[model samples]
Target: MAAAPQPLAPDPAADLALRLALTIRHDGQGGVADDLVDPDGLTRWVHAHAAALPAGELPFTADDAALAAVRDLRAAVRALFARAVPGEPSRADARHLMPVEEALRRLNAAAAAVPVVPHLTWPPGDGPAAGHRAAAAGAPAAAALTAALAHAAIAFLAGPDRTRLRACHAPRCVRYFLKDHPRQEWCSPSCGNRARVARHHDRHRPGAGT
Candidate 1:
């Protein structure tokens, strides 16, 4: 079986929105890779991201419609992510990114596709933490999943975590990541190494920094 185009380590704090944006990632061979290639891929992805999505009593299986919906939403998300961070965005889809307004419209439309309500919980000493649950129990699985993904994106964009979002411009790397430390530049150690090597080459080329 053909594997995903790009397979890299998962972010330590894998926020759902971040995860969705990461569905398209660097192949480490100077090419962009996509994970959601078909219905099976979508089903796997959704099931794997259970913690980040709304809880369903029954397992949600993806169909062609679900796959298409999520993929389109991802395009909007990645475009918005590009706008969120500083400097150049991922090269793979930079040329074809939808307009900012269009992206917002799509996100909103997907989010509203399913009715949802806040599920809140307050522990002993902590404030209430809010979560989501589809208001309609019988809503289509596809709609619920896509809406959940869209809702996660909205939360991520509006939350403080968005401030730390960064674009990894390391050589052969194309991803958006949350900066864990003040000095973190690349998404992972491998990317950092690649970037360092690239920089060293740039500094010690035949021209010798002319």
Candidate 2:
């Protein structure tokens, strides 16, 4: 056998956050690219959480309720990711907070069924510089998640840096991304397409058709 396909391994917390961000943003499209995804209310939560983290600070202000909600959501998301596997389901005290915790618990079961192979790690803990290099080499989802965690931890511990954070530009969509592209707009094409279609219809409708 060719190495027996090592099991997947991802940073449970970071992976969960990122996954939750993407999932909530697009309404868990079942990983289907063409599927129509909606932002809903939870999507807004992700955007707010990501935005709270600023350029040089952790974005956790004692006076900011938004930041507090983000903290709760983060904790709930962490629980879902950490207790993803069978035998011990994740639970959270989000009763006073958003239903994101419960939402993710349901979503986690779906994720585990996807048959995704965990990413591998090599030369582990050598630091983020090398971790990023490996991530660039397509280290798999788990590896990628771990690398993401490393970046977040660094920012949390050593101060923030504007590396991959971004805000969407779509009129109605408010979400954050890893800044994979410099000109990214809205969080997904669905938002862009919806805007475009609505505009097109408005322009060609009844009296305006002139």
Candidate 3:
């Protein structure tokens, strides 16, 4: 059997949108693994992504309802990501992807659910930065978080960097990654090695050179 895909190392340079799509990845058991499996998971993920989220959006505590909302948004994000890459979709849910049209609808709806206003902040020498603030004073935490993620995803997909998106087809990897370098193939060095090994075995196997 093929070696299962491994979890990737922390990459601070990855876009927030791409990071969210990566929450659903390959498990060691040759199956899919979801990071946002519960309210705690969702809360952890939100805090981990603090640098990219809006300022007032911090201090978040996810409940079951927020967990469900975020997971639904994540599903739409992954489905759209699967459609953005060059080759085949990730094997994790290739047969179960929502239609591109449906994914689009869900994403748009989530993004529009929470109204937002522009925010500008400057951290000393870090220079001025522009972000958003939730305009709906009564909006639930779930709505705010979901809209933030959806907007980030929209920006990534509609920007030039979209061309860098690629799906890792090595072994059991079910990841979508940005091709940081021109020659990069797999999602990581380990995946590249696995692909190379699989290729070598395919070429040298018992075909008797026929």
Candidate 4:
């Protein structure tokens, strides 16, 4: 059997939207590495981020169709950010927005049966808390998953942090990361080294800039 795919490293400051869009890695050699290609991987992804999901409504058995839908949604989100982030006058392409809109529609349809309400509670050994909960019992798991992802995407795009979203321009790297620091560019040091090497190679190419 193939080795199980490694879980994505968690960044306390990264939002769900950034994480979701990065499910596919652009190999810089004109190919992509998709983590959601298998049902088991998809299931693990959902479980790993269980906190964002509705209580006990995890989509642990993602079918082929569900996997395809999520992949398409991921692509659309990536494309949307690619265009929206760097442009002086940012604009969303209709093509990219369609899938997101469709996802949201499905989420709304699926959530029709669930009621969202706010509640307060004090954990047995923790401080009191207040938060909203979706009464997701009996709700379709696939729909709940889609809705949760869609909602996160919407919030990320519409919120103030959208300006800080960026795609790593490093060689052979296709990951998205939040600009936590003003000078940060690549997603990681490895990517940064790759980018520097590529630049050095380009500058030293035979008869370059002649």
**Cand. 2 TM to true fold:** 0.30
Query: For each candidate, what TM-score against the reference?
Result: 0.85, 0.30, 0.87, 0.73
Mark the 10 consecutive residues where model 2 has the least summed lDDT.
Answer: 30-39
Question: What is the descending lDDT order?
Answer: 3, 1, 4, 2
lDDT (10s digit) by residue, model 2, range 76-131? 44343233322322122222233545735433433332222234345576643222
Question: Model 2 clash pairs?
Answer: 8-118, 10-142
Candidate 4 pairs with clashing backbones: none
What ranking emerges by TM-score with the best candidate at the front?
3, 1, 4, 2
Candidate 1 TM-score over all chains jointly: 0.85
Considering TM-score, which of the candidate structures 3 and 4 is the better prediction for this target?
3
**Any idea how many clashes model 2 has?**
2
Instruction: Give me the displacement of residue 197 in model 2, in angstroms.
Output: 1.6
What's the count of clashing pairs in each model shown?
A: 0, 2, 0, 0
- Cα-based lDDT for every prediction: 0.81, 0.37, 0.82, 0.64
**Runs in model 4 with CA error above 4 Å?**
1-14, 26-31, 87-121, 128-130
User: What lDDT tens digits, residue by residue, belong to model 3 across residues 74-128?
Assistant: 7888888888888788776697688889889999999999877888888887989
* Residue 45, candidate 1: alpha-carbon lDDT: 86
Candidate 2, superposed: residue stretches over 4 Å from native? 1-17, 28-71, 75-164, 169-174, 202-210
| Tens-digit lDDT string for candidate 4 (31-72) | 667778887778888788777654555537887766776666
